[model samples]
Structure formats: structure tokens, C-alpha cells
Target: EPEVTQTPSHQVTQMGQEVILRCVPISNHLYFYWYRQILGQKVEFLVSFYNNEISEKSEIFDDQFSVERPDGSNFTLKIRSTKLEDSAMYFCASTRALGLASAQYFGPGTRLTVL
Candidate 1:
């Protein structure tokens, strides 16, 4: 079976430094999303990218963050400046459909460790 892999090299970052975690989801999926889970908390929606633009984002995604698809195969979440509280497990997913008719698919998650 094909496995999901996270490029941790892209996640290494220092506080106040820009960091990006790259995710490559299934090609046929049309909607891309990022969700986070703190060590002791429930999952939270961070942002959604569609049609080459951010279609929806949560309060957690502020001016310091951005999401983009630089190419057909990669979806990225960038933090302009890192903060200690930013540490968490970030999950990336994609779906060919949306809402009720859509089946969601997830990629391997990358953890963010802020110092």
C-alpha cells in the first residue's frame, strides 16, 4: 500500500522565524485543509485552501500564517513567525468532494515543536 510521508525538513524552525510544513495529498482531491491537535486537546480546524485561494480559515489562523499550493502536488502551511504556543500536530487532508457528498482523505501529520 502507498504510505503517507511528511517532510520534516520543512518543519524545522526557530521562534520568530518563518517555517513551512509541506504536505502532499492525493492528486484527485480538490479541497485541501489543515487541522491541528494539541497534545491534550481536541482537533481544531485551521484553514482550508481551494481554487488556489484560501476559502475558509479559523480564528487560529491570523496574520502570522498563510496556506498555499505552489504546485499541483504540494500544499503548504507557512507561519511567518513561530511562537511557543504554535507547537502541535498538524494534519493535512484532501477531498475530491465537499460537505455531505464528499469523502475526506488525510495525509500523514507533521508535528511542530517550538522553542
Candidate 2:
């Protein structure tokens, strides 16, 4: 079965630096999303992308953040200026369909530690 893969399971960066979290979502999936879990907090949706543009984005998706589908299989999240509060587990997810409650397949997650 196809599964989501994330690179650099853990990263440590200084404040104000840039970071790019990489993800390869499951093949044949159409919807891609980014969600972050801050330690013990709940998973919060950052953004959802489809058809090349952002389909939806939460309030947490601010000016410093961006996402892209560089190719057919690769999805990337870029943080222009990271802050200490940005430290968290960044998860990439995808679903074969999009609806009221389509279950998403999540990657193991990339832990971003901003110092």
C-alpha cells in the first residue's frame, strides 16, 4: 500500500531562519493538507491544497508560511522566518477524496524545533 513519507524526521533551527519540510503523499491521492501538532495540543489544520491553488487555509497560516506541489508526487511547506513558537510536529496528509469527513492518511511527521 502507498504511504506518506517525510524527510528529516527531526530538524533544529535557530530563530528567524528558514525551514522546508518535505513530504511525499500517497499515490493517486487528490487532496493534500498540512497540520501541526504542538506537543500535547490537538492537530490543527494549516492549509489544504487542490488543483494547484489553496483550497482552504486556517488562521494559523500566516504570511511567513507557504506550500507547493513541486511535482506530481512531492508536496512542500516553507517557513520564511521561523520563530521559537513554530516548534512542533509538522504532518502532511492526503485523502483520495474530499467531503464532510474523509479520513486523511498522515505521514510519520517531521519535528521542527526552532531554537
Candidate 3:
């Protein structure tokens, strides 16, 4: 079975530094998303991408955040300036389609720590 995979299981960076988180979603899935969970908080949606363009995004995805599908297999999220509040477990997820019935496959997540 195929699954989403994230790189650099953990990342430590200084505040104001840039960080790019990478993910390879299931090969056959068509929609991809980025989400983050602050320590003990609920998972929050950041952005969604499909057809090589941003489909939707939440308010948390501000000017500092960007998403890209640079190639066939990789999806990435770049945080232009890391902040203390940006430290969280960032998750990558994908689904074959967009609907209530479609189940999303999630990656293990990449933990980001800002100092």
C-alpha cells in the first residue's frame, strides 16, 4: 500500500529563519493539503492544492507561508520567517477526491521547533 511520507522528521530553526517542509503524497491522489497542530491544540488547516494551483487556504496561511508542487512527486510548504508560534507538527495529507466520503491519507508529520 502507498502512503504519504515527510522528510526530516524533526527540524530546529531560529526565529525569523526560513524553513521548507517536504512531503510526497500517495502517487494516485489528486488533492493535497497542509495542516499543523500546535503542541496540544487541534489540527488546523493551512492550505490545499490541486491541479498545480492553490485550491483553498485558511487564514493562518499568511504572506509568510507558501505551497508548491515543484514536481510530479513532491509537495512542499515554505515558511518565509519562522516564529515561536510556528513551532508545531506539520502534517501532509492527500485524498483521491474532494468530498465528505473521501478519506484523506496523512503523513507522520514533521515537527518544527523554533528558538
Query: Per-residue alpha-carbon lDDT of model 1 for 21-86, expressed as tens digits?
Result: 888878777898999888999989999888899989999999999998999888898889999899
- Ranked by lDDT, top first: 3, 2, 1
Return the top candidate by lDDT. 3
Ranking by TM-score: 3, 2, 1
Q: RMSD of each candidate?
A: 1.9, 1.0, 0.8
lDDT, candidate 2, 16-96, per-residue tens: 999999999998889999999999999999999998899999999999999999999899999999999999999999998
Question: Which residue runs does candidate 1 get wrong by more than 4 Å?
Answer: 1-5, 9-12
Better of 2 and 3 by lDDT: 3
> lDDT of all the models against the reference?
0.83, 0.95, 0.97
Regions more than 4 Å wrong, model 3: 98-100
lDDT of 3: 0.97
Candidate 2 Cα misplacement greater than 4 A, ranges: none
Question: Which has the greatest TM-score?
Answer: 3
